[model samples]
Target: MRIVADTGRCVGAGQCVLTAPDIFDQDEDEGTVVLRTAQVSGDALERVRQAVHICPSQALSLCED
Candidate 1:
């Protein structure tokens, strides 16, 4: 699985950060979503998916490869 964030759509609400801090981060200056990992553990994948769902701007997506 891979994670992708549409930088153009990110408003940096930090929902992804709250859901998966290991994989997502907030940019201090821009307040935007920062993807720390393209691939995550199987256990972490579900949480990442939840993060994608909770993003108010829908900037996050989980791609199964």
Candidate 2:
């Protein structure tokens, strides 16, 4: 699985960070989603999804490949 953040829509509210800090981070100066990894463990999928769901700007997307 891959986690992709649509930075164009990212407001960097840090919801993703709160959900999965290992997968997501914010560039405080830029207020953007910083993807820590394109690939993630199956165990982390649900948390990643939660982050995507909680993203106020709908900036996060998970792609299973």
Candidate 3:
């Protein structure tokens, strides 16, 4: 799967970072979602999904590659 983070739609709720720090982060200055990597697999997939679901702004999406 591929992870997509839309900074334009991000509200800096930080739920993504809190749920999956390995795959997501926050920009220090803007407080926007920063994607550590777009690629995801294995055990990390579930975590990434949780992050996507918890995103209040619905800025995160997972696409099948």
- Poorest stretch of ten by lDDT in candidate 3: 16-25
User: Which numbered prediction scores highest in TM-score against the true structure?
Assistant: 3
Kindly list the per-residue Cα lDDT of model 1 for residues 1-65, writing each as its tens digit: 88989989998899999998999999999999988888976789889989988999999887777
Per-residue error (Å), model 3, residue 43: 0.8
Clashes within 3 Å, all models in order: 0, 0, 0
List runs of model 1 lying over 4 Å from the truth.
Answer: none
User: lDDT (0-100) at residue 61 of candidate 3?
Assistant: 96
lDDT of 3 by residue, 17-60 (tens): 88988889999999999989999999999999999888899999
| CA deviation > 4 Å runs, candidate 3 | none
> Between candidates 1 and 2, which one is better according to TM-score?
1
Candidates 1 and 3: which is better by TM-score?
3
RMSD of 1: 0.9
Positional deviation of residue 37's Cα in model 3 after best superposition, in angstroms: 0.8
Candidate 1 clashing pairs, residues 3+ apart or interchain: none
**Which is better, 1 or 3, measured by lDDT?**
3
| Models sorted by TM-score, best on top | 3, 1, 2
Instruction: Write the residue-wise lDDT of candidate 2 on 1-65 in tens digits.
Output: 88888999998788998999898888878979898888987778889988888889998887878
Assess the local accuracy of residue 19 in candidate 1 as a C-alpha lDDT between 0 and 100: 90
Q: TM-scores of all models?
A: 0.93, 0.90, 0.95
The model with the greater lDDT, 1 or 2, is 1
| lDDT scores in order | 0.90, 0.86, 0.93
